[model samples]
Target chain A: MKEYTMVVLVKQVPDTQNLTGEAMKEDGTVNRSALPAIFNPEDLNALEMALQVREEYGGTVHVITMGPPSAVEVLKEAMYRGADRVYLLSDRKFAGSDTLATSFALKQAIQTKIPDFDIVFCGRQAIDGDTAQVGPQTAEKLDVPQLTYVESIQELGEKKIKVRKLIDNGTEIVETALPVLLTVTDTANEPRPFIAKKLLKYRKAACEFDLPKILPRYPQFKTKEELKNFLKKKGLFIEMWGLEDIKANKDDVGFAGSPTMVKKIESITLTGKGFKKIEPTDEGIAHFVAELIEDHTW
Target chain B: MASNGEVWVYAEHDWNKLQDIGIELLSKGRELADELGVKLASVIIGDKVTRHATILFEHGADKVYACEGSKLDNYDTAKYAKVLTDLTGQYKPQVVLFGASARGRDLAPRVASKLRVGLTADCTDLQIGDFKAPDGTEYKKILYQIRPAFGGNIIATIVNPNTRPQMATVREGVMPPPPSKKGKKGEIVKAIIKMQNLPNLTSILHREKTEKKVNLKASRIIVSGGYGVGSKENFAIIRNLASVLGAEVGASRAAVDAGFIEKDHQVGQTGTTVRPALYIACGISGSVQHRAGMDQSAKIVAINNDPEAPIFSIAHYGIIGDLNEVIPMLIEDIKKRRVE
Candidate 1:
């Protein structure tokens, strides 16, 4: 079997489903701190697809994410689920990035860190933005073919890969050459649960910022560098990279590189007045039906 | 880079018939162009789609760029993106619009990335407006791409101040198609497609266009259920009401996510937008995202046990009761009234 090298992109998004009034600031910006961050739902599907591919073809699944330093939590979660390696791309310069600028940064990171990737998997869209643009845009930036809304991998040969993708009112099976990008959908597969053994082993994984809290607990490690070396020896270090690590242009990595800007944001509020109340009795129902008929609403 | 002061819409089609979203965009494109004092153009790519240009003109396009070839009959992302990008480079239109359908979502991002311009997805509204940046820079007469974000909790107006040919994709049924004129005149330009060296990367082995199982867009009345509908078994009551009233069934995102109904029946920001004659929301709390889809209906009725449910705010008739009891009575009454 040909051992393939795969990369899966993931994100930690605010749980929008369980949002409260405090989820939005008075200025119409999202109060991300008020909401709990979880691994993006569909990204788990992408991770599962990559793990399945690795299981069948004897390969390694590398997971990567771009966000704040706290995003390393998702990297650790990926390891618990079966990822072989994890990397975090974080920097203050990479803030306020739209999908286009975000794709450029991810493409640069991929080129710098994992240039020999055979397949790159991404979720169809994240719940936060729901744009579904970054995967295809990154494929365009990387100058590779893309397959979006992939439901399954029909066949995988040495150089060609066949995939079934969902479309409007139908589905299509397409064949593309190697090094193609795929955006997996929720319908693709059920994500596997965390392995207890892997959970116990990878729970100690720590990134650069996590060392401040983690190192103090262990007096044997005198310095952060020594702690990092020890974690690296134990395969428990989560790699962290910034804009410089990926050789990204300052003008192309964040707000300055984004072409679109938010002009205004209005919080939605429902306003209802002067509605006719109806009783839920038999007579009341009959009267309402008769009125509906009179108004031709039926 | 300066634009050519024209608004362009990508005219998607099935065979020779223009898709609904394409026509809807032309209607919007015409309004935007008239506001800016410019011409409205449309780009149609398919084999022998020149006749469709007349329909585009009737709808609202003042100019149609027809790229005709046998190989272009079926949609190939690479080929279509190349044609649109090349035309954009040549003409430099001030604004471009695409339908946020499957193909549009797949192709728009590629073109936007290739041009390094901004592209907003699933915009609910677009207008010509002015924008002032945070650094005191100002832009006038740019496209204000308005869309709901954060699960429709807030509406954001986005502007591409520094990028030319501001691009955005609007979902179907969000914008209404303009009335067709008996005879409308427009210039038809034949675009020369150069596909010699482009890599033939993807090959479609098979395609199955299933008959659309549900089309809430065309329904005159909709009976929608929400998470409060309880469970999959209780959804039968909703179906009974819809069948009695001769209405199509719809569901909110909550109901769909709870496995109470199929996603096709979802009427919300993430599913389908519908403007029906009558919309009866059953046991639905009416989140902002759900209201964004069906709020345009002519009349709305809400039935929920909780009086504070947001659905009652927009509803013309508010019934505060259990849907299980109210729906059965309503169904029986309607059935008896029809015979009488």
Candidate 2:
């Protein structure tokens, strides 16, 4: 039996689409609470693909995300959909990292969370960064095979797999050896929604056992022991791990491991240039055709 | 401080015929190689690709390293990168170039990272060093890699300060194809391609291919509708024009937001990048995001009621009337022209 492990990279970004009048940030970075947080549409599609792969063949899907602790909201979504394990790399030290530094943190997490990597997948690009660099860069750091703009994955074999790259006209079918990385386009497939049973069971579950939301809802509890007892009774336990639990060096947890620095940020709007409509006369048509000819165009 | 002499071009295959961009890079590489006084080589890998190695001679490749074996059957980025990276270490080219297709987009970053070098993607132009009078032309021999930056607002000239081989990915149709001549020949170097058995990474048991693969990016003609198209029902008139012109139907971001069409047909920064031969805007106001997708089209025609719409900025032809009326008339005129 061949063992297959699929890892998907996800990110948390402000809901850029829901820019309303009530809350607006001049700097372009959103106010965290005012802006809705959702799993990236493309990353969700990537996870849907991974879960489907798991259903067809018996394997594990591991999701690794690097962000603030609030990002765990999406991890629970992944777990609800048959993920074998999930890991988060969250610390204030990783703040203000650009694409280059961001990729470094992800590479470190991929190594720490899963010792071995067979196939890694991610959305073509994130809505916020829009760089589309991290996936390919992560594959480079891992020194594995990569396929981008992937429209379909045809088959998976013992030592090799076949994939379809959406090219200019027709699809290009490729048969490559295993341990390949894929950065998928949204054209791949429609993502699946949450299951009714999984949603109900895992609603209040936490990995950190946060005492804020749960204890207050049930005010009858008098002591810390009773609250823990009720939480255990209600299945609100989370598998929380401290920094030491993951065996990461204290220095490497944040800004120290990052190597990229932001240069600047600018907001721009490009529109309304020149609009000159010429006559339907021969000279006017002749002038336009001549320019096209000079430019070697159709 | 390293060997800044060898110029490498990544090759492509179309219908068993070599991709024109591969030779285009070589032709451009010749100019750079001449200025730097270095050698120009190509990397070609495929099943039975060794037989086509002679194609490099027609161009200006001085050396061709062919990696042809059973393991080289398909393009696996891991295997391809390993082989290409090994060659880079051995040859130490001054620059490595590839077509900016999907493969190139993914491959260039990996190669650059492995070599710990810089890579400029979707480059539009290439020029060898500065002018010759020390500053006049010799500086250009440094291979000024030019690419569109700031979302195509400006073109930036990038160069690797201290890397063995500077790398770049160039878009298709950006440069002219290489011309064929009778007499140039190059040496073909053969290398062994080995593979390693790895674990089963991902099991994609079944992938149902999309029944309809309508890629608008490569289409020659695109007919795009906008908010001026009125209700979603009016989109039929726009579609009629497209059907007659044998073109793909597109939508401005506003049109997609209005539910006039699916997001896939939307042409803009958030949708798809398109550079067709001809673009027809049906009552569009031309938002910046919409213009970003079709600004590169060769010709544009706008039909709007406002007359003050921004889409007129790029339109080569204009009709200040309703699209419902204008589209039918244009379709009639095109039919007449074809019949005549």
Candidate 3:
């Protein structure tokens, strides 16, 4: 059996569905701090697909994400669900990156760290942005074929792979050559739960920012760097890479590289003061329907 | 630098028949081109698709670019992107718009990335406006791509001021097609598709297309449910009401996400935007995302136990009661009236 190297891209996004009143600022912009950051939903599906492929074909699944240091939480979650390795592409210079710039950063990281990868998987879109551009843009940057809205892997071979993709009205089974990128959709499959043993083992996995909290427990390791080295030896370290580490040019990594800019944001406010209250009784219901009929709203 | 160039719409078609969104965009494209004092052209890339250019001109296109070949019979992302990218680079279109359909969503980003320009996704509205950078650099007459962000908590207006050929994928049904002129005149250009260097990496094995079961955009009235509809079985009440009233069944994104209904029946920013004559929201707590799709409906009726649900605010008639009870009574009342 030939082993393949698969990379899954993931993100930690604000829980937009369960937003609190404080989710918005007085300036009518999102207060991202007020919302809890969870692993992007579809990215979990992508990870599950990668894991399933590895189980069938015997490969190592490497999960990567680019965000603030807090994003290491999703990397740890991915480890608990059977990922072999995790990388955090973190740098302050990468902030305010739109899809194109973000994809450029990811492409640089992939080429620098995992250039021999056979396949790359990504969620169709992130919940917060919902632009769904990063996956294809990254594929273009990598100079590989892209399969978007992929629902399932139909066939996999040494040189080619086939997938079922969801279209506007139907599904198409498509085959592409090796070294391709796939954007997994939510309808693909239910993500597997965390393995209890893996969870217990990786619960202490620490990135650079987490070293301080974890170092207090390991007294023999006097410094955070020492603790990080010890964790690396124990296979519990999540590697963090900056823009320079990935060989990305400073001009192409952040707001400086982004073409689109937010001109304005308006908070939606609905006013319903003119609504007529309708009773729950049959008579009121009858009268309401009659009015609807007379007004041709029926 | 390309401000005086033509505004182009990617006219997608199914087996040579132009999609409705293409015509709709041509109408909007006409207005934008007129405002910019340039031509409004459409690009249709498929085998034997020249005949569709007639409708494009009738809908207000000033010109049509038909790129035809036997290899272009079906949509191949790499091939189509290559042709469009080459055409865009050569002709220097000032603005490019796509329908934001599945194909559009897949193709637009690839072309935009190749061009190294910005492309906004799922724009609900577009306008010609001026934009100023924080550094006091002013840009005149740019495309303002308006869309809901953060799950519709706020609407953001985006601009690509420094890029040529400002590109956007506009949502279908938001921009209604203008009335067509029967004998509108336009120029037609036959574009040569150069596929020599393009990689053919993907091949379609089989395609299964089910006829679209729900046409909420064409429905006159709609009875919609939300997560508060409780269970998939309880959704029967919503369907019962729809059946009784001869209306279509619509579901909020929450309802569709909860597995209470299929995605086809979803009505919201992420789903179908509708403007039915009557929209009855049953047990739906209208988020801004939901209201973005249906607030334009002529009359709205909200039935929810919670009086504070946001659906009531935009609804013309409000019922502060349980939908499981109020809906049945309303259904029965309408049934009895039909019998009488």
Candidate 4:
């Protein structure tokens, strides 16, 4: 039996899937008030796939996320399911990063926070951007192989990873070497429910998945010892990593590492109006129905 | 110029069979190739997919790029990316088009980002040459890549002038395939792709294909129901309509919420986005969410008593009456039309 260590990448997004006009920020980013924070739908699936791997193959599932301090909520949600550990990659410097810069920031945090993981999984793309670039770009940054549109992770062995990828018209079976990144599509797998006890206990726990960053705001946490005490009282599990923590070169560690840049942000509207419904004349409607019958494609 | 370089298309395969989109892409690629005066090519990477390669040539690929091996047998994201990215860099095709299928949606953007180019997803239309510069302040010459935006309410033409190769994903069946010779001979460009070392994190143990699957987007005809149907029981009207038309049953978000149908049957922004030729929207209010999915239908017929229903805004025909009366009447009329 080959042991495995899986890392799932998550994002703290304004529950835009459920967001309304109310969540609209003046600048187009979701208004935090209007949009409730939630874990991305695909990221949850990635974590679930990881947990299942651990359940079947026996290993650890570590979840990591990059966002504002509030992102800890998403990491905790991962823990409630069965992730052995979670890491929060929160830094003010990480703000305003597009897909290119965003992937670099996350690669740094993943490298520093989790030393060794056999595989890395992420949602095919973040729903907010729907760009679907981060996972593949991250794979490029990590210099590992990547598989997108992954519907199923078919096999996990020491040397290889096989997945049933959902193609447009059919399915493709894929096998690749490990230590690879995977961007799971919506068809990947449905997430299991949160563990009752874990959810109940940690329901109110402060989302302090990153200790170093949070300590700066709470001056009362003057020392590591004091912060640990406060964390204990708060029952906060703050995963920690610093610039010196990983084998990261300063040049390629942050904004400098990314290649693509967003030149401008525009709130552009796209419309489509076609499908000329023939008038509901008995003759026209009947002919249309006949056409439908001939096509056999309802 | 489209003619300066060959038109590159991402030919899709499902291990055993080639996707219809691959052929559809080839058909469009041939058109684009003609528009630009170049060749059409398909990229196939898998194990023993020669059968598919022959099919690609018939669909109109002037050339085929096939990488066959045990490692290439099944798709490994990392491996496929490296392989495809390396191919793109070497071939340097002007435009690479995908099907906007689940796999295409995921793979296209990754390749685009890797190549530092621009990509448009879920497009319903494709045209060669320049597009308007959407820049508010300055009018720059940009590659007008247009796609349905705001849930199919408008067509947003985007561009990535700064990048090298432009990429776009078209929905299935938008461009029908041209008649191709099943065994047409074409030159196969075999390449040696180096596999990158990767980590093992998670794996799949089983695959049970019995999930509530809905292939609405792929259907040719869709009988979509909406809130005007009143109750879940009214869906029988839709089911009947579908049976007469031999069409797949679809629902608006409202109908899905009313328990008229499963989420899989729901069509909209949050549901399955389809571009069927004939769309019959019964009692469905054309919310942006609902329209996003079915609005791309080649033809739309709306049935409702509410004359001002938003659906009528786009429907080709609107019947001002109850669907219960209209649907059954229409079903009988169709039965009569069949005889005629």
Candidate 5:
């Protein structure tokens, strides 16, 4: 059996479960700090799928994320779950990226860092953008075939993989050659929880962002490079890449490359009207049915 | 500019029957064609879809491009995508619409990628408008792709001004299906794609239907329960109500997460979005996540213990009470009314 190399695309999203009115700012932008940051739900499924592939095919699973410096938290979580390597794709020039620009930057980063990977995994969509376009768009940018809504892997051959994809009514079995991209849905599999040993080992994981802040605390490390060297030597550090490192055009990486713009954002609020409040009695039930019948509710 | 001056709809169908979304797109496409002073076209790719062009014509297609071959039979993504992309390149359409069904969702992105055009998936509403860019340039006949974003907190309107044959996958049931006109005919363009040259990477071996599961998205009436249902066994009340009302059973994320029901029955942001004719929410507090899926129902009836539950705000009828007590009474009354 041949070993496979997998790249999983993950994102740190604002927790939508505990959302509140304060989560949205006056400018229609999300106040990401108003809510806790968590790993994007579907990305966990993608990571789990990648890990499953690694377990079966005997290969390494690497995770890549694009966000602010704080987004490295997801990388730590990925390491705790099971990722051989992690890379952070972040820079100021990458801000305000829509699905297109984000995919462009990610494609460049993948091409630069892991060009020989067998498979690229991504969640169907991000909870924040809800576009579901980045994965497919990124596949297009790389000129690779992509399968979306993948439910399971039926077989993994040396050159191709057989997959079952969820359609609207049924599942479609497809075989795609290696070096393909797959966008996994939540129904793919239940993501395994963190292992105790891995958690304990990776809890001290730090990237470039944490080096400057933690260097002051360590008396022995006088320079940022020295601490970084120590952490890299200990295998407790994550790799960070910027626009220049990936050779991505600045104009094609951010807002300038984005074609879709939010012309407006309208908050939806339901006004309670035209509804008859009824008590939980027989008469109330009778009136409701009578009204429904009169209005042809059936 | 390749202005074919026609609006095309991809007629998605299984081997047995045509998908309703195909006709729904034709209905919307007809309106767009009239607005743009163009013809409405349909593309069907399958083994025996040549005979189904009349069906497309009746559903408002002014022209049908039928590509029939054995390779097009089982919906190999690569082959069907190549046929559609080739046809589109040969005969360019101003705009193309596809059903946001499973096959449509998969194929649209591939064709769009090949064509290097923009595609908006799962659009709830589509409109034709003239878009004025912020740079002061004007684009005519733009496809306004409207869909819920940010977990349904807001709606975003997207326009693909630079791409030809602007593509969008309309969500099933968002647009009404036009009544078919019997014996209606249309011009047919036959392009038999040679499958020998294409890459055949995948093949289906055996297909077992994964049980006849709940069809909540396609159901006309749905009775959904939330975490307030208390226990997994307490779901009997919801099932009993659905049986009496002849409706499908649904659940919120809380109920599904609690193991009260399976994931397929979940109706929320992460679940299936539905636009049923009537929705009865029992013990549901109507969180944004839950409401995002079913707020488009024509009539909503909420039954909850708390009078201030957010579900009541969008409901057409609100009953303040315990669902266990209220549901049994409603079921009994409905049964008696049916008997009478």
Candidate 6:
């Protein structure tokens, strides 16, 4: 098998299950701190496909994420799930990025940090942004082919890969040239759980923000640089890059670069005229259908 | 007249027949164009699909740009994007709209990126408006792309003021189909696209319909269940209700994720968007994700034990009781009504 390099773009999103009324702030922005964050669900599916590719064909799986310092949580989680190397694209300037700016920053990171890649994987969309544009936009930025709503990999070849994509009512099998970007849907594959040994090894993995708090426990490593060197020697240093590290143009990143602006956010309330509640009895059931038929509901 | 400053809608077709969403978009484009003081045009691309341009006129398009070639039969993202991007550069439309179908979703972003413009996906609503950005800069004649986000708990109105030809993909079946004006005629401009210059990066190998066939998008009535349906076997009540009502069966993402039903039967943000004449929900809590798919239905009927379930909020008729009891009673009553 030919060795290939795969990069999976992941996002850490607020857990939708833990949503509360306080999830939205006064400014209509999501209150990220209120909700416990977890790895975006479909992104894990993308990660699994990348890992599967590595397992079938000899290669390395690297995970990349662009978010706040807390996003290292997904990077470490990626390491625990069999990624060989993880890079964190974190910078204060990269905040409030819409999908366009987010994709630009991610494309720069891929070009500068991991220049060569056989395949790029992304979840269909992030639960927070809910925009499935990043993967295709990145593919467009790199001038590569993109396969969205990918279901399964049919055949992997030296120059091309045949895969299945979901359409409106059917699935189409397509063969695309190498160096393609694929946005995997939830049906792509069931993400594998963290390996026990890998979990034990990567559980202690910490980025720069996490180092100071954890360094005090390891007295043997006196300085932050000493602890960093020790972690780097053990192949556990999480590669952290900022906007400057990736050579991203400042005007083209973060709030300044995003073209779409949120004019307003209104909480959804289903204000259908008050419904008529019916008793679960034979007479009531008959009246309900009669009302529906009279009202042209059917 | 040229397509410049015109409101353009990409009319997606599959070789022979035009997609329904294309007509729906033309209906919407007519309004948007009228409001923006621009002509409404439709761009039709496919192998031998120029014949369908007449339909565009009936749907309110003032002009139709038709491109035909064997290479345009099957959708190859890059090739389609290149031709569309070239047209966008030349025509310089103020706004571009597409159906939020699979093909549109794939093609819109690619074109948007190639043209370095903003494209909003799966917008539930589109309107012309003046918008003030967070930086306090005001923009005029912006396309307000409204969509449900964050599990559909809230609606976000997005605007792309900086990019020319502000683009958006609206969901199918949400908008009403236009009333066909049989005598309406439009000018047809044949676009000469060079197929040789396009890159063939991807080729379609095979196309197969999934064994589980459910056309929720076209269904007039839908019966959906959620996690409250309990077990995979317990979903029979839902199926039984659907059969009685002659409606399609639908499932909430929770039920689909729980293995109670196939993904094809799922209806939500990640699944299929549906607009039926009547939607009957049994034991569903109606998360915004599920509601996003079915809220456009003309009427909704919710049956669940929990009165506080969000499903009741939108339901035209609500029944607070066990679905096991309610479904059977409803089915029996419907059977009696047939005889009566």
Query: Which prediction has the highest TM-score against the true structure?
Result: 1
lDDT of each: 0.89, 0.68, 0.90, 0.70, 0.83, 0.86
Q: What is the full ranking by TM-score, best candidate first?
A: 1, 3, 6, 5, 4, 2
Clashes of 5: 0
DockQ measured for candidate 6? 0.63
lDDT of 6 by residue, B149-264 (tens): 77776798988888788999998877888899998899998887776755536999888765547889878999999999999999998999899989999999889889999888
Label model 5 with its docking quality class. Answer: medium
lDDT of 2 by residue, B236-332 (tens): 9888988987789999878888898887788865666677888888878875456656777777878787776767867777667766766666666
Poorest 10 consecutive residues of model 1 chain B by lDDT? B13-22
lDDT of model 5, residue B308: 72
Writing each residue's lDDT as its tens digit, candidate 5 over A143-262 gives 677888888988888888888887666777877777788999998999999989999988888988788778877799899999989889878988899999999999887777765554
Q: Is candidate 2 or candidate 4 better by lDDT?
A: 4
Model 5: CA > 4 A from native: A20-33, B1-4, B192-200
Candidate no. 3 TM-score: 0.95
Q: Tell me the number of clashing residue pairs for each predicted model.
A: 0, 17, 0, 36, 0, 0
For candidate 3, list the clashing residue pairs, or say none.
Answer: none
Q: Candidate 2, residues A148-195: lDDT per residue as tens digits?
A: 777677887876778876653346666666677777878899888887
lDDT of 4 by residue, A1-298 (tens): 8889888999876554554666554543334455577788888888888888898999988888877777788877887887877777766555555565666666776766665767899987665555566787677667666777688877788978888875444566767677888878767788998999888766544543445556787787786667777766665555644345544455444444433233323342222344444545677667766665676633
Candidate 3, CAPRI quality class derived from DockQ: medium
Query: Model 5: what is its DockQ?
Result: 0.50
TM-scores of the candidates in the order shown: 0.96, 0.71, 0.95, 0.74, 0.92, 0.94
Q: How much is the lDDT of residue B258 in candidate 1? A: 96
TM-score of chain A of each: 0.94, 0.74, 0.94, 0.76, 0.92, 0.91
